[model samples]
Target: MSEETPVLSLPLIQPSQAQKHVTHNEALMRLDALVQAVVLTRDSISPPSDPDAGECHIVPSAATGVWSGQDHALAYFDGTAWQFLAARPGWRVYVLSDLQTVFWDGSAWTGETASFQNLNGVGIGTNSDSTNRLAVSSEASLLSHDGAGHQLKINKSAAADTASLLFQTGWSGRAEMGTAGDDAFAIKVSADGAAWHTALSFDPGTGLATGDAVQTSATDTSAGRLMRADFGYGPGNVLGAVSESAGVPTGAVIERASTVNGDYIRFADGTQICQFNASLSYISAGLCSAVWTFPAGFVSGSTPQVQGTLNSDSLAASAPSVTVAGLTGMTISGLGATSVTLNVNALASASFGSGESVDLGVLAIGRWY
Candidate 1:
């Protein structure tokens, strides 16, 4: 009836009451070895040849020697013999040999590091919650480094597989940049996820960029060239004139006729303009005539202005009333969009005499858009 009696089982009465202390002391010794005991091993059937006192082990099936027929029992070495304690569910034991914590779960003992199920959150060196399921709030995070320069790779199943990092808004993709379906590095954007536009791409083989209608190779057919800004300027500032270069000239002024389809390059000073020029020769047995065709066709609804000087090779004794007849002898008899005609004769006299040749230096001013 004393407190030294076993909690679960009472010792049998011996022949003498004086030896009750022996039974009580034995039960207390077993309780001291089993309570909060650290076992050296589990499922060990064979007894150690040299077990230290107070060392414990979980009895295995078909155990031999003192542990025989005591499977799943906590066995303790009390230096003289083995003491057994029945294991129940939720009993925990620390294995000193393996430095692991193990517990009995109704059926069997399992290690603490084994896989778990239905965990809400897990944190390493911190506490986690439902929002952050697996949070590791640390200064730096590392992955797959085994003592050398390491590369973090995101591999796909095949060559035509898409492997990219997509930035999303509300779980919808906005932009993606990576090797999507190819080896070339590409950056693509999308307003809606269904249709995507490639903004830029860099070819790994050629080291060239292709986008924005810019040519990537020197042998391309189009006459496209790179344009670079001279410098940055403030807003609302007027740009200076650019000199003529391999491309179109900057600060160029153009003028179109009001009544015609003629466009011309008009300069700032208006001193020089683009014009058509021609020289005509005429044989004079009567009124000499010649026609000039424009090199570039003139614009419709425009009449070209013609001016010239005429030279006559004839001087005769029977000269006309006007001795100097050549200066005032030429006239623009006809004019059209594409051609002009000039008439040459002796001024206020008969037609130019036989064997006289007339030369006219003519100029036409007009526009052909």
Candidate 2:
């Protein structure tokens, strides 16, 4: 017999040897449809009323008509009637309705593809070279969008669960950022992965940022301030200080000798306290008093303490009775806002001669505003 003709393991019986080929041909017709078979549908249990010739189906259990009692058998439609073939293990068939190839695995049909394991790389839409494994090249790749807006959530199992993205250098962790524990977002960096510094953190509950050297508030109320600039001792410096100009300190507070000939303490709020010393020389002999101008922003009615030393040997050795010249008996006698008068009675009861001078040192303490 030719390859197209099916050879059956059956005795050929014929009346007068005429109908022998008829039965052989009938068996061959069934084999033609069953070999390398394809099925239009697999889910329908009921046989169609008008199945065309060579059309086949997997006969479901309790099927009616010619398909009855032939569950899971290949039922092929010959030109005249239906024919059944028992399916064996590894019987492969293409299911046209599902557009997939299924195979019988001794008991049931499965659609699993052949095994592919331990590949060096696999690329979709692009060529995969040796450097990558399972590379998918696309303009963009989206994930987990079933319906509405989607969120790619990296969730942890508990409050102490670490869900973070770690950046590495030569397989050693350099930095990491995410929710390491609890719901707070944190960013940490490390020279070595074992010791990490939390550089920044954000609290979800309070909406505040906090960390080792970072803060997000104006005041320190358990939380720290927003900004803090620090300086450390540099070359030849006794202490750390910040300066906007070379050799000049322009910080919130500065203590320095004034270039305009005085000593001053200045605050960030524009308040200054100054002290100075001066020599009051007499214009002529018999001079007993002199008025000194007060520093700017001096408070009226506030007495400035004054002490003096005689510039010449013009009086007896005794402390002069010093007072504000206008206000009798008061050391800071004429206590005006801008100036004050000093009455210096040398020798206890007498005045000094011409060209006599007194070196006066005054300290006025008050606020600017």
Candidate 3:
């Protein structure tokens, strides 16, 4: 009942039509132009001055000249003039100039991309080289995940090879981190890319670290090195060693250890004290004397500060001096580095002074080392 097809609007011949060949030929012309449609371009707004017969293009927006008011329509040229055909939603056409296939989605033409499941290389805006197969010249790149999490992993086949991320400045490596060599986790840096210095490294087997950042030796007093407990002094072994260098002690910060030398106690700081108790016998009615041998402290031929105290209870006399008794103090004489002599003279109650005996305590302080 209608004059043309509903979808393509091609002229339809009706029964009893006078010139059926004219209408049928017109339908055939429409088929020749639209089927397997191919176009020179999809973005040109101006009609070509010398378009050949059967030359086609998708008229762009703001079209001028003969293509005016035919935006987004397929413009096909016949031998005589140009014809504008309304496009459907799913019409696909190959664009020769862009070397791509595009589809009509009602308003404009969009690229018709094929599946890229197993492409050998994909260079977005640059040429793909053999080594860098998927090269892209971009300001930034993003590899995000579908929803939750994402990870970018790099792997290597052998331990001797590197698997790491390198940071660079001006295409020269400045730092690198990860397992670099021999299965060890390492962080290395370089001012110049050729020579690398390991700032931090971890041994995979023992989990111990070794690098310029760690302090592994005992005598490392340099700056910017971490002090290890076993390799340096700490609370457990504060008195690590004893050395007086440049008239200043280098080790043993406090008094935690001491050396015993017979009656002498020697300290790590070079201080020694000699403490002893002695018994004296009277040689005369008012005199008593005792010989003392020095302990191992107090360097040879050194005089030390000496002090003595007598046991007061022993000075009492049973003779009672016929009523009460008294005695004078003691004296130190014949002093030497290794020995000393002490004498006590008692003048009170001479009758009871003879054979008098008493106990004495002595102390001496000096340096040992």
Among these predictions, the greatest TM-score belongs to 3
Q: Write the per-residue lDDT of candidate 2 for residues 1-369, one digit (tens) a residue.
A: 333333322234455657678777766775576567798777777888888988888776677776788888877788678877777787888888888988879787778596678877789898888765666869987787678878767789987899888888887999999999777999999998789988888898987777875633323334443443322222333322223334233443443344333455544333446565545555333344666664454444454444444333332222143323311221446666556665544433345456555555555555333
Candidate 1, residues 1-369, lDDT tens digits: the string is: 444334434354466578788777677667676577689888678988888888889887888987888888888887788878777677788988778988888777788876667788889889888876776869987787689778867788876898888887887999999899898888888898878877778898986767543444423335543321222122322233322233333333333221131222333222112233333333554555667665445567677676766433333332232245443556886687777777665654445554444555566676443
lDDT of 3 at 192: 95
Report backbone clashes per prediction.
0, 4, 0
What are the TM-scores, per candidate, against the unseen true structure? 0.37, 0.43, 0.46
Two-way lDDT contest, 1 vs 3, winner: 3
Per-residue error (Å), model 1, residue 283: 20
In candidate 3 the C-alpha lDDT for residue 263 amounts to 70
User: What TM-score does prediction 2 earn?
Assistant: 0.43
The model with the greater TM-score, 1 or 3, is 3
Q: Lowest lDDT 10-mer window, candidate 2? A: 321-330
Query: What TM value does model 3 have?
Result: 0.46
